[model samples]
Target: MTLDEFEDTPGDEAAPIDMLEDYFGARGWSCDRGGDDEIVAHVQGSWGKYELRGVWREEDRVLQFLAMPDIRVPDDKRATLYEAIGLVNEQLWLGHFELWANSGILLFRHAALLSGNDGPTLELDQAETLVEAAIDECERFYPVFQFVLWGGKSPREAIDAALIETQGEA
Candidate 1:
C-alpha cells in the first residue's frame, strides 16, 4: 500500500500496528506483522540496514519503536562504545541509543504515549514521523560508532569527525 492507499484508510478503523505495517509496506519496505500488536521491518539506511520493530501496548496505550543497526560492538570496544554512545546521545533531542550488552547489539528506542484525554490514538502521520526520526538519527550517528569501534578513534574524536558538515556538492 502506498501513502495514497494509506490515506484512504479510515483512521478510526485501523490499529496502531496496522497503521505502522501499512506505512512501511507503502514504501516497498520488507516488514512483517508479527501479531496483532507487533510489527517488524527492515529498512535500508545510508549507512547500513536497520531492523525496525514496533509494538503497540493496548493496556498501557503506548507505542514503542526500536531501530537496530546491523553492527555488533565487540567486547573489546564496548567501553569505548559506551562513551561514544553517551556523547552521541547528548546531542539528540528524541530517543536514545543503548547497547544490549549480552548480544552486543546497538539500538535506538523511542516510545509514544498515546493515552490522550479522549483515548489512545496513533495517527499515520505520527507513526511516519517516529519511524523517520529513528532512521535519521541512526544514519546520522552510524559513522561515529564505526569510528570508535573499528577506526580506533576516541569518543570525542569520533563525534567530531562524524559531525563535520561539508557545504555544497562535490
Candidate 2:
C-alpha cells in the first residue's frame, strides 16, 4: 500500500448533511450532534451487540462498525499492544491507507484483510485489493469519503500538531 499504488483523487464538494440525516433516519438512528460542519449518529444494529458510529464532517462521512478485541492484555503488556497497533497502522499506511488529520482511511480495502495474527506479513496484492474495496465504498458515498479523506492532514503529523497546538492553547 505505497502511495504509488494509491489512486489519489482531488477533493470534491462537501456532502450535504440532509443526505446523512435521511439515511440515518430510515434506520432509526438518532443524531448525536448537529453542528454546522459536523454530525454524529449512534445506531443500534439488528445484532444489538455492536454499536455503529456514523460521523459526517463538512467534507466527509464514515460509518464505523465497532467491536472490542477478544484478547485482553495485562497492564505491563499495553506497550506491546501499542507497538503492534503501530506496526499494523504503518502497514496500513504503506498499503494506501492515507493518514488524514488524526484518522486513517483506505482508498482500497483488501488492506484490512492483510492484518492477520502475525501482523507483519502483509502482501502488496492483498493491500491493493483492500484499497479497491474502499474505493468502491467511497464511490457509493463520495461526499462522505471526500470529507473524511481531505479534512485531516496525515495522521502522524496531526497527532504531533495536536500535542503542540493543545499545549499552546492551554
The worst-scoring run of ten residues by lDDT in candidate 2 lies at 105-114
lDDT for each candidate structure: 0.89, 0.32
Candidate of highest TM-score = 1
Query: Please, what are the lDDT tens digits per residue for candidate 2 over residues 68-144?
Result: 11123345434333443443344343222222222222222221211224322223333233323433333332322
Off by over 4 Å in 1: 8-13, 116-119
Worst 10-residue lDDT window for candidate 1 reads 6-15
Residue-by-residue lDDT tens digits, candidate 1, 106-140: 99999988866566667877888889999999999
Q: Pick the candidate with the highest lDDT.
A: 1
TM-score of each: 0.92, 0.30
What overall lDDT, based on C-alpha atoms, would model 1 receive against the true structure? 0.89
Global local distance difference test of model 2:
0.32
Candidate 2: residue 58 Cα off by (Å): 4.8
